[model samples]
Target: MTRVRSLTAALSAALLLLSAAACGSDGDDTPKSVAPKTAALGTLTPGVIKVAVQPYSPYTSVQGDKIVGLDGDILHHVAKKLGLKVEPQVTDFAGMLAGVQSRRVDITIGGVAWSADRQKQGLFTDPPYYSPPAMAVRSGKTYKTVDDLKGLDLGTVEGYVWVKSIQAVPGAKLHAYPDANGVFDDLGAGRVDVGFLDPLIIIAAQKERPDLKISTQYLTPPTAAEVKAKPAYQYFQPYQTGFYLPKQATKLERAISTEIDAMYANGELTELVEKYGGDPEQFLRPDDAAAAARRGVDRPSDWTPPAIAK
Candidate 1:
């Protein structure tokens, strides 16, 4: 009877131990199963990503209360990849910058160019596109170079770097407008003798109105000797477009840059540009380091738009 009692006690203890082990295993898994996943970068408002945009057609614009353009499409793709929703707010160029700076918007993307001045103001992601400045004149007008517009009224978008460039020309009257359409409208109406704008904008305008003609010429960065001889032209250089984020959003910037690089590697970036009636190759940098070295700029080489993915 003593041995029987002892055996029975041992069996009970063993069963309790087994039951405790089973409960412990379940407790371990319960936390993991109910644990929340880590949030993606740039998720400012939980599931919503706010983007500020300006009226730059083919890049970003409002169409009957709907945001439609390359920038809008790109933003949507990025938001989707992060399992977030995009809320695009249409504003002017200055407002776009202010929105990002004030944290009112997570980012701004509407032909926003990456430049030294802009870098000081906010952060930028990898280059999404490239655009060289070009001059446009009324149809049947001839301008072999920007100098041809000297001493005449030159229309340019206000708040654009081109404003200073246009003002640099001797006697080139500066006519600043709120947006590209205003500049193009004045050009079409002969309110300005010539218009200084992005080559892509010039092309789009020409397509819209056959009466407007874009010069085959592009504004080139002044050579070293030229810069020394004419320091006024030092600001003139090619520009790359990117999304502007707040200065403190380093992680967000990294996230967007990674997405841009991945898009470039997968041909998604090129597809977006092509779908918007742009040349994919034109937006890519052949050799960013070499290009920046040749231009004597401190811009990022790694941020260059990569070649289309095979």
Candidate 2:
């Protein structure tokens, strides 16, 4: 019943995006003023946002011609506020990374982890949520800590935030795949002893194969890592999920951040997340480690996230 409700809401959101996409603006390269308002974003196209997306559900997914997910729901409200049309293009992970860099698309979505290395590729929007990476192992196996993974074969998607940390694990063999499906497939087939991936993807995989014996465990790394120089490694933290825009799209980044802030302030973001099968408290709010990861990023010295009610 919950799944059906989520699907129903997702379809409704997708319809809203489709309607917005249909309402193209006249010859003007600015935010469109369809009804209520048009944001003053320095968009590449006039009143239209060409977005790149990979089909990662609960984040973003290709449902027919429209994109739907938690990210998509946020985008729907954001577009309505700014009076902009959404044009989403479906592509693989590489295309999502490259499309925004080349300015071929105004932005890209679908569970892009916030990282310093990837930020060098393009501008990343403020995160709407943060999710922990998962350690997928055979059911009943007691592998909880990083030390437990020694000498075992592990698989993860290419460009995942934990790749560096996983590689740093002594005696652990890392196999990088192009996408999440391949990682789980290999894990189920015993090609790899473990699968290191996003927890949501792990949930989806488990649903697909209920008979498969697998368990989801959150990643735990040491407080400080002298081995890896990265901040995520130093803290052993989860990544903030955000969007990638063209390198010079600072104004656009700020504009989008403002809308995200509004949603957070009014609890819209949390409600939307919860309705989509996400745990708002777990994934939406940043814990101590994630706060450390945030400080490591290039935000203003005085920067702070929306205050959660105690």
Candidate 3:
């Protein structure tokens, strides 16, 4: 009887060991103790919020082995708040978006806008700020509206929101470039009459190359015909900009977004937008609730602007 009892006890202990081994093999539930401090942030890699970045100046330009730009600056602040470090992965614009979606990175930045189509693919935070589309022209040239682009050759980065609207122009030819620098180069070479681009990028380019003798004009919203041709045109009246995040990281996204709202309340957002994107009033304020809805934002009827609104 004593020998039988001993064998039964050994069998029970062996079964328990087997169950624990199975559980240890499946690691989906939590991160290991490598960096327990940032594990709570729910990042793929502990102790870091990996960000996909591009060379779109003033947004994600690399400055001497460091990513120093408006978006990175804001992200660093948020990461610090969460007790994590910012790890920027330099890539092209399209790659940046793809990286986050593929889980290669935790988030992407460089003026990602609020769009219903994009929202379906990944997650977006409430916009950090709003900015109007800008047209880059020769130093003394002026273009007040989209109508002024008629019959002209326009250069722009491929995959921009304004591409279709520029294509809708009755006589204009939309010259697509792989990157913003290409557009700026053609504009400076007089190869293209104007460059349709992000205001922050143009501002950074202006600061970098005074020799280019280029200037920017804040474009008015495209005409109704243009909007009809490209339904995406409606986001152009000073559209909201956000960070793109992987769909699976809901907790991480919410945490970062909460930090952004805190920054607004603390005036850090206001100060950074002014220092980089320029025009505090224009960049810090979103469109009225009515217009924002047209751009695919589901803002409430009684919604009010953030603290930085002018």
Clashing pairs in 2: 29-46, 30-46
lDDT by residue for model 2 (61-94), tens: 8775467887888887887677677877766566
State residue 45's C-alpha deviation in candidate 1, in Å. Answer: 1.8
Note the residue pairs that clash in candidate 1.
none
Clashes of each: 0, 2, 0
Task: List runs of model 2 lying over 4 Å from the truth.
Answer: 1-39, 158-163, 175-178, 189-191, 226-236, 287-297, 306-310
Candidate 3 Cα errors over 4 Å, as ranges: 1-39, 62-66, 189-191, 223-226, 229-232, 289-307
Global local distance difference test of model 3: 0.70
The candidate with the higher TM-score, 1 or 3, is: 3
TM-score of candidate 3 to 2 decimals? 0.75
Go through the candidates in order and give each one's C-alpha lDDT: 0.64, 0.68, 0.70
Model 1 residue 114 lDDT?
68
Return the lDDT, model 3, position 36: 50
Displacement of the residue 193 alpha carbon in candidate 3, Å: 2.8
Q: Model 2 misses residue 146 by how many Å?
A: 1.0
